[model samples]
Each structure stands twice: as structure tokens, then as C-alpha cells.
Target: MKGIIGKKIGMTSVFDPGGKQIACTIIEAGPCVVTQVKTEATDGYNALQIAYGDKKEKHTIAAEKNHFVKANTAAKKFVKEFRNYSEEKNIGDTITVDIFAEGEKVDVVGITKGKGFQGVVKRHGFSGVGEGSHGQHDRQRAPGSIGGSSYPSRVFKGMRMAGRMGTDRVKVKGLKIVKVFADKNYILVSGSVPGHNGSIVLIQK
Candidate 1:
């Protein structure tokens, strides 16, 4: 399988051949240039490093600047490797949405939006204590009795507690490729993906 670095341009509903509106997440795919190729004999593994999007010189580090120079291109804002694709690709080669076509299936991976510091009710989906109709008082949102009264009084090591949520690498598998507009350098997959709008996502097939 190969992967493409892309930015989630947002989502929209588009009519399929069946004429039914299908929910799709539009992503600005490549125009990605191959920056490097790592062979197994030399690098111990095969991979193709691809660069996408432009980054200013001020924000580019020296090592990365030198890397882009080898390709005769500016440092990209994002760069990633498609493992095992090195043998077939070369530096300075470009890939685009043409790699994908309509009616295909792909896997999308990205970091989800962070919802800072959430409670057990939201994180663990715990139903608050006490019967709602009874004398619940302020115990409605409380996590009543974390453990047994006498036996094993200490809280369990893996007990779920209130903490940060989201902002984790999430992979959505088996998303249908509803549309591929190569002329526009974008593709649309049927259904949702991780991360908010404009967040970078990796699509693999």
C-alpha cells in the first residue's frame, strides 16, 4: 500500500451515480514532490519521502533546507514517507490525485481536535450517580464510590478518570472514495475523517 499526504479541505455532500447524496470529506491531495528515496540495502528499509505544501525559509530548519535543496525545491510545510514505495519512485517525481480514482476505498489517519480536560461523563460516558427523580442533590455529576468500602480500598491502576480528550492519531478504515477530481487536485471520500478542517491527513490505499 502507498500513502499520500493531504490537507482536509472540509466536507460536503455530492451526488453519486446513483443520484443519492453521499457525505464526503474533500481533501486537497498531492502535487506532492518526491524528495528522497531510501533503499533497503542502504537505509535498512525502503521508503519514499514526499514533500507537500510550501514553507517559508525563516521557519525552515537548516537540515530540512538542505534536504529540499537536493530536490531543487523549497522546504515544504509537511513531509512524510510512504514506506516500501522507494524502489519504484525517485526524487523530483510528483504525485497527484490521479493516484486515486472514483469508487475506490482508502484509509485516512490524522490527529483529532483536542477537547481539553473533560469529565468522566464525557470521557468515559458514565451515568451520574443517584436516581434523577429521587434526592439526587449535587451528586448528579459525581462518580460515586470508586471502589469497595473495605476490600481493596485503593483505586485501581487503570481506572478511568477525568482528563484530556481527543488530539490523538485516529485511523478510519474502509472509507469509500466517492469522487476524485484530478483537475482540481482534490478527492472526496464518503464519510467523515479525523481532525478539524485544514488539518493534515494521510490517505493510504
Candidate 2:
């Protein structure tokens, strides 16, 4: 899979050719630098290690600084390895949003926004325990009857009780590219994507 790193730039609606309004996510796709190239005979796997987003020189360690120096690129904040990337790219090569074309289907990978601690109703879509009327009291949001009494005794594994929510690694596939701005390094894709504004995302084809 060939891909590029990008920053989420929120979403907006655009009019299509037939005057239909389509909601799309705007992303600031890379101009990523090829920091390293792994070969089968050398690293036991084929991959391209790319880097994106600038970082301060003072914040970079000596080893990483030397690595970027060898690639002729500045310190990058986000570094990722793309396995089995088919493009014939070498170290110091620059990849931009031009690699993707309009109307092409791609997959986007990102981290979802965190929702912190939550209950069963909001987390697992469980209907709250009936109503508070008829002496039901505060049991409305409770997770009812988690056990089988003397049969199972204990709560079963994989129960959908609430704990933490969100901040998960998510992949949204089959997203069509609505538009591409190569000069500005932006690509608009149809439909929603994971992550908040300015979060790092991977667009793979």
C-alpha cells in the first residue's frame, strides 16, 4: 500500500458537478520525505520509512538528527513506516498529495477523539433500565442483571459494560477523493474521517 501522512483540516460541504452537495473532509496531505528505505536482503522486509511535519532542531536527539541529516531533511515530528510500498523511491525523495488523484478510492487511518469515562447507555448503546417511575428510582442508567445468580455466579467476560471510550485507532475505507490541491498539499475526500482537527492521519491507496 502506498500512502501519505496528513493533518486533518476539519470538514465542509462542496457542490458536485450535478449540483448535489457532498460533505467531505479536508486534509493537509504531505510533502513527506523518504527518510529511510528498507530492502528484503538488508532489513528482512521491504518498506519505506517516511517523515512529516517539522520539529525544532534543539528538540531532536543526536541520533535522530544524524538520521535526518543523512536524508537531507529537517527534523520531522511524525515518522512512519509503510510496509511493501511499491513506489520506486529512494532516500531524500519527496512525496506530495499529487500521488493521489480526484475520484480515487482510498482508506484513511486515524485516532478517534477521546470520550473519557462513560456509562452503558452512551458507550455500548444499551437502553437504560426502564423508567424512574414506580419506585425505579436511580436505576435508569444502571446495567441490569449482569449475572445468572447461582448458574454463572460471576459476570461473563466480554460484557458490554461501560468503562472508557474513544481514543481508538480507526480505519475508514473506500473514501472517494472529491478534489486534490497539489500546490497547496490539500486533498478533500468524501465522507467523515476519524480524529479531531489537526490530528495526524494516514491516507492509503
Candidate 3:
């Protein structure tokens, strides 16, 4: 269970050896510094805390500033804890894009783009009842008939309806690593990842 924090750098198409075009998402991965190491004997579990991206000192609180100072690293914007890392690395160690190799299967976790206040037609894919004919002209995209007539009249819980869409913590599994550009700190993964451009993502293997 080795992973790194990265930024979504957008998507592009790459030509494979078979001359077929493969769509890939570009991510600017690591140079992540280990901020802390938790052991089972002390923290009741084993995990590594890694931090990525540069953050201003003014934006950091006093406790976090002291924590980063103890780790001997500058303030970072994103910090995540990963359990069952492949190797035992000490705090203050740096992990880079070189940790990933081309043609490896990995899982990417990220937040999806937010679509505020969506309708049931677009959000839940509800095909409205009643046709356009017979005086039903304007009810084409409406969510028809929510509750029953008499018994249990209130709307049922967990009913899919119109509301906010996207902006969810989504995990995409089994995405292949198409390329690794360690020199530039960029890695390309096959298929799409969650979130918009410049959003943070976690890649796990």
C-alpha cells in the first residue's frame, strides 16, 4: 500500500506501441516529505504521514508549524496518512514520482467537480412521467409523484431527488500508469481521474 499525493494536471492522449491512442490523465506527483511515522506500539496502528505542496508559513497554525519543524521540513499544503506503505521510511524522507513505474495498476482518489443545485433529470437521471401531449407540455423534466396517497404519506428516506451533485470523494480503481516522467515530476495514468484541473489527488498501489 504505497501512495503519493498529487495534483491533477489535466488529460491528454498518448500513442501506444500498438499505434493506438490511449487517453491519459496527467498528474504532478510528489516530492512529498514524511511528516510523521506512527507505530502500532505507540499509536495503535502503523501508518506514514506524508505532506505535499508548499504552503506559506502565515497560513499554517502554531501547532502545525511546530510539527513541520520537528520533521525538519517546510510547511505543506496537503497532508495524508497512508497505512501499510511498502517500505519503512523515516520522517523527513522525501518520496517522489519515481516511486511509480510505467505499466503499473493503481487507484486514484480525488474529489469530483461540484455541480450546485442540479435537477432530478440531470442529477438522478429520472425520466419524467406523462408525455408532452395531453396538456403535459411543461412537465417534461420534472420529478413526478414522490409519496403515496394515504398510508405512509411522507416522502421516504434515501429517495433520490434533485439536489447538489458531484464534489464527492471518489476512488477510481485499476487505472494503469501509462508513463512516468520523473525528471519533470509528472506521471500519466490511463483513463480519467476525478476532480477538475489543479485539484489534489491520491494515487495508491
Candidate 4:
């Protein structure tokens, strides 16, 4: 798969050629410079590490600074690798949003927003035992009757319960490429993708 690193700018609505309004996620992608090219002989794998975004030199670390020096470029805030390509490329090569065209399909991977310590009502979508009309006072939102009185000795292993939620790596597949603005280094993808605005996302074609 051919992959690129992008930042989610925000969501916007654009009119298609047929005058239909399309909801799209705008991503500022690319103008990424290749930092290193790993070969099977040296690294036991083939990959190209691309770097993008300028970072403040005062806040940059020594190791990352060395990476930029090797590529003869400024320090970037993001660096990612794309592996196993059919074609060969060299270091310092730039890959922009121009690689993707309108109406193409791509897969996006990112971390979802965190919703900490959710209940069964929001987490697992449980009905939670309703009102207290049947002499049930405090048990308004409870997963009633987890098991019987004298049946299994313990709860089921894969039973759904309320605990932590969200803040996980998620991938949405087959998102249509609604539009591509190469000059602006932006691409519009249809449907919701994981993560919040300015979050880094991996796009694969």
C-alpha cells in the first residue's frame, strides 16, 4: 500500500460536479520530504521514511535533528515510514497530495477521542432496568440479573460491562477521495475519520 501522513484540518461541505453537497474531511497532506530509504540488505526491510512540518529548533531533540541533517532538511514535527513499494525512490524526494486524485479510495488510520469511564448506557448501550416503580429505588441504570441464583459460579468471560471507552487506534476503510487540491497540499475525504482536528492520520491507497 502507498501511504502518506496528513493532519486533519477540519470538516467542510463542498459541491460536487452534479451540484450535490458532499460532507468531507479536509486534511493538509504532504509536501513531505523523504528522510531515509531503508533497504532489505541493511535494515532487513524496505521502507521510505518521510518527514513533514517545521519544528522549532530550540524544542527539537538531538536525535531528530540528526535525522534532518541526514536528509539535508529542517526539523519536522512528523516523521513516518511507508513500506513495501513496487517502485524505488531516493532520499530527499518529496511526495505531495498530487499522488491522489479525485474520486479515488483511501484508508485512514488514527486514534479516536477519549471518553473516559463510561456507563453501560453510553458504552454498551444497555437499557439499564428503567424506573423504580417495581420497588426498585436505587437500581435505575443497572445491568439487571447478570446471572441466575445457582447456575454458573462466575460471570461470563466475554460479558460486556461499563468501564473505559474510546482513546483507541481506529481505522476506517474505503473512504472515497472526494477532492484533491494539489496546490494547497490538501485532500478532501468523505465520511468521518478517527481522531480530532490537527491529529495525525495515516492514509493508504
Candidate 5:
């Protein structure tokens, strides 16, 4: 697998060759530094630990400082490990957006935007109980009956109910790479990515 840590730069529309307007998410990917190179003999697995985004030295701890020092790079805000990396990259090496190309398919992993507390209508797309005419006061967004009267009287586990929503780690797969701008370290993906604008995301192929 080949991967890079990136920041979502928001969305935009571009015109394709056939004159079709394509909506895509702009991501500032890579120019990441490889912090560690784990091998099967030493770490019992092969993975490349890369770091991206600048972080303040004052906020960095002693151990983290030492780790970044070994990579000969400054402290980074995001770090990710890609197992079975296809390329042979050594410690302190740099990975850039050039690893990906236009029309290539990749997967993006990011945290969805936190919607805070939500109801079943927005959370699970549950249509609220009918019209509010028949003595229905706040039943518009209610979850209705939760459980049965008897028998399995308790509410069953994994029941879809209104609660905390979003802010979950989600992986969107098979998203096509619409364009790549190596000069700007940006890649336009052919779909919407998770998280809000400027959020960190991991692009993997």
C-alpha cells in the first residue's frame, strides 16, 4: 500500500475533457517525512511511519522530539503508518503527491464531522411518527416505541436510536483521483471526503 497524510482544502468543480462539470474535493497531500522504517525482523512487521504538517516545538514532548530528530525533520502534527508499503523508503525520506496520479483510484480515511447530539430523524433518517394532528405534541422527531411489551422486554442491542452521531473514523474507498498538481502539492479527488474543511485525512492506494 502507498499512502500519504493530507489536509482537506475544501471542494470545487472542474470541467472534464468532455465538457462535463465534475465536483471534487481538493486535498493538500504529502511532502511527508518518513519518521520510522519498521521491518519484519525487528518490529515483526513492515510498515512506513510518515509524519506531516508542522507542529510547534514548545508543544512537543521529549520523546516525540527525539523521534522527529532521528528523522531529521521538525515536529509534525499528524503521523500515520502504512503497512506493506510498496516503495522502498528509508528513514528521513520524503514522500510527495507525485506518488499518486490522475484517474487513479484511492481510499481516504478521516474522521466525520461531529454533529453533536442528534435525533433519529437526522441521525438514522427515521421519518417521525406521521402527522402531529392526533394529540402528537413532540412526536415529530421521537424514536417511537423502543421495545416490545413482554418476552424480549428489554431493548435489543445494536438498535438504531438517536444518540451521539458523527465524529467517527470513516474510510471512503474507491474514490477516483481527478487531478494532481504536484507544484502545489494538491490532488483533486472525484468525490466528497469525510470531515470538515482543513481536517486531516489519510489517502491510501
Candidate 6:
């Protein structure tokens, strides 16, 4: 799979090697900018479209300014793809963070940090409905019994109640690569990685 397209740049701690501290998360990744290269007898499969940050050719338009001028690279701002791409990229190729190293184990897609209208005790840890004198004033955090007084009467479709929580799209599997600056393209990653401080992440592998 192989991937790259980051921005997080926040947490920190380091110290491992028997010292034990670890924490990580810094990101930044990619010198990215491959721009196209699809092919599989002409776009039937094989991906690799890359692109990252640096966007503003008057907000860019005209077919994305002729699709980044056939990869000559300029107006970016994230444009992922990467399918079946295990190297063999072309069309202004770049891909950085030294393609990942340190200890390996990537996989971080992101977008989870909106928390707009949360409920059910911080969006889903629940633990509400009980406590607070025998009277149960506000019924604690309420989310109690959504529906049911007539056999499938309603409310039962992935029924986790409580409306919109985070921005969704999370992925975060594995994670470990604690450090790999590549002369400051940054990398760090080892713990928390959803979106928040600087957002935009991908990092697959």
C-alpha cells in the first residue's frame, strides 16, 4: 500500500531505548507531489495520485489548473489516491518522510475532532441514567430507553442514539514509527493521531 500525506505536528515525549517515555505524534510527512499516474490499461486500477498542502493559485480551478499542470506541481492542498501503489510512481514524483522508517508500522488516516453536539456522556461512553438521589433529577446524562413499547415500534437502526459526535473518518491502526525526521520532514508518530492540532493525516503503509 505505501502512503504519505501528513500535517499533525503536535505531541512529543521521546526517550525510549530502555529509558521509556515515548508519546510521539509530530507528523508533517511527505514532500508529496506525484499528481497522477493511474494506468492499468488506462485507469482501470493502479493508483498513486498524491499531492499535499501548498495550494492557492487564486484558489485554483480550471480543471484544478489543468490538474496541477500535468504534475509540474504547485497548487496542492491534499489530493490522495494510493491504490496498489508500491512504488513505481512518476509524474513529478517526490513522496517523502523517507518513505517512513524508524520502527515502521504506520496506518493513520484521520478526521476525528469536531465534537460539535456531543451527548450520551461525551458522545458514547454513556454511564448516564442512574445516580443522583432516588429521584433521579435530570436522569443523570439521559439517553435512556430510546424506543420500544410496540415491538420494533421505531428507533433501531444502529441505535447508538446521541446525534453527531466527532468529525468521523477515523482509522488509526497499528501506529508505531517513533521518530524519523529525514532532515525535518518530521515523522515521530507512536500514539494519539486523529485530527486536531493541524489536522490532515494519512500515513498508511
TM-score of 1: 0.93
Supply the TM-score for candidate 2.
Answer: 0.96
Name model 1 segments beyond 4 Å from true.
Answer: 132-135, 148-153
Leading candidate by TM-score: 3
Better of 1 and 2 by TM-score: 2
Across 40-112, the per-residue lDDT of candidate 2 in tens digits comes to: 9999999999999999999999999999999999999999999999788999999999899999999999999
Query: Any idea what lDDT model 3 has?
Result: 0.94
* Residue 72 lDDT (model 2): 96
RMSD of each: 1.8, 1.1, 0.8, 2.1, 1.2, 14.1
| Candidates sorted by TM-score, best first | 3, 2, 5, 1, 4, 6
lDDT of 1 by residue, 88-107 (tens): 77788888888887788899
Tens-place lDDT digits, model 3, residues 64-139? 9999998999999999999978888998999999888989999999999999999999999898776899888789
Off-target runs (Cα >4 Å) in candidate 6 are 1-4, 7-26, 31-36, 49-93, 96-119, 124-134, 137-139, 151-155, 161-183, 186-200, 203-205
2 against 3, candidate with superior TM-score: 3
- The alpha-carbon lDDT assigned to residue 72 of candidate 1 equals 83
TM-score of each: 0.93, 0.96, 0.98, 0.89, 0.96, 0.36
Question: RMSD in Å for candidate 5, one decimal?
Answer: 1.2
Q: What residue pairs are clashing in model 1?
A: none
User: Candidate 5 at 175: error in angstroms?
Assistant: 1.6
lDDT of 5 by residue, 6-102 (tens): 9999999999989999999999998999999999999999999999999999999999999999999999999999999999999999999999989
lDDT of 6: 0.86
Residue-level lDDT tens digits of model 4 in 1-205: 6778999999998887799998899999888888999999999999888888889999999998898898889999988888885456677778889788888899999999889998888888898898979888877788776666577867887788888999899999999998898889999999889999999999988
lDDT of 6 by residue, 1-205 (tens): 8898989978988898799988888988878889888888998989988998898899888899798888887889889898998879799888898877888898898998887777878888899988889887888888889888888788877978778888989898898898787988988878899989998889898
Instruction: Go through the candidates in order and give each one's C-alpha lDDT.
Output: 0.88, 0.95, 0.94, 0.88, 0.95, 0.86
